[model samples]
Target: MKTICGLDCCGACDRKEACGGCLKTNGRPFGGTCVAAEWMKKGGKDEFLRLKNNLIDEINSLGIENLQIADLNLLNGFYVNLEFTLPSGQSVKFLEDKNIYWGNQVEIPESDRCYGLVADDSFLLVCEYGCGGADPQIVMFQRRQAGTEIKKQNLV
Candidate 1:
């Protein structure tokens, strides 16, 4: 099986040895829960798709220039997690290396950089990075407002 998130699991992942793939690991690859797998397992594929589509809508509505998102794929945290330097000079990573989240990549129109977007049920993270994900910089990180949570009851 590719993935419970309805996306190909082996597309571009580099942690297959550690992850054993989502299906082989029973949805808990890397010894942690994948938000996409958990949601899809709990509420079914259609519900999970709704949640993902809703998130895409939310990201688009942010009015970020050149960030018109089309879809969010199931991304392993280890692949998309990049350390970001804050204004205070402290660097931090907002994602767990073992968890899975919904994310996408959008290239800047006139630059060599690309925008990386990662989101779970609680927050939205936007970042820019160079080729091979070098020099990642945080563009924005926002806590998803109230009433936007996607749980079992919220799936409908």
Candidate 2:
């Protein structure tokens, strides 16, 4: 079976043996009290599975007929520049980047802190910071179409 890296999917943490994260002690990535895990477990297995499917659906709905992967730079993080057309006939240029952290939770740098963007499909993009007992802030952004008079939806 094929597997995705720790990027979009959960993988066995190399630091799990010595790390103090719940996943490290539990031997499973999803079953933990971590914020992300807790969010996923809120409604049990079905909800978690639904959330995963929703993420996949959002990616597919982007209709990425073509995709390009850019060079990975440690300082700049891993980036991918996407040029794709939306179903509404609008063209979109999206840049996505991923940074890895070995701590118990993910943190977004102060410079990167901003309101999150949520897709029409309910998938959210936000900066997650802190670990263990730290409370993460949920930043929200407004997404809008160019030249359209419609008000943008406040993403949460």
Candidate 3:
């Protein structure tokens, strides 16, 4: 596939035949471990999927009626957000809690659902909740270009 910055390394890498691709190689096409790839490799995608799916379930349970996909943010726990506009025209925001035990909830004002997406890129998250009004939905996506430099660290 492509690097985090969206470089078509598979097409240009001389070892594509042996390596398969960066996604498969964990971004270590030539050598050295890529931290970001490592994070995703070591159960990160699974965690992300769990959170995303859980969000869909929680939203559907709200029964808020006609809640439309107003906005979404897929940041790590510290910055996750999902917003919906209620039938009443008020906004509803679901924010991720820093406390691992607490999970997410509808708390912030609907107007606060303004976190930006990647603008132009493939959608990684596509969720459709059964809100029973105009098919409320949220699509979270990201566009990675060769210039989209990425850095990964242990954090701890």
Give one clash count per candidate, in the order shown. Answer: 0, 2, 2
Report the C-alpha lDDT of model 3 over 1-156, residue by residue, as the tens digit.
575324343565454565445666555543433323443444355443443344444434444444324333322222233455666887764433321111222322443332122111212222233322233345433232232222333332
Name the candidate, 1 or 3, with the larger lDDT value: 1
**TM-score of each predicted structure versus truth:** 0.86, 0.31, 0.23
Alpha-carbon runs more than 4 Å astray in model 1: 11-14, 151-156
Best by lDDT: 1
Regions of model 3 farther than 4 Å from truth: 1-43, 68-71, 75-156
| Candidate number that wins on lDDT, 1 or 2 | 1
Q: What is the lDDT of residue 63 in candidate 1?
A: 86
TM-score of model 1 vs. true structure: 0.86
lDDT of 1 by residue, 1-156 (tens): 487667676667766776788888778999977888887877777778777778888999988899998887878888888988888999889998888888899999999999999988778899999999999998899997665555564444
The TM-score-based order of candidates, best leading, equals 1, 2, 3
RMSD of each: 2.8, 16.0, 15.0
Model 2 weakest lDDT span, ten residues long: 68-77
Which predicted model would earn the best TM-score?
1
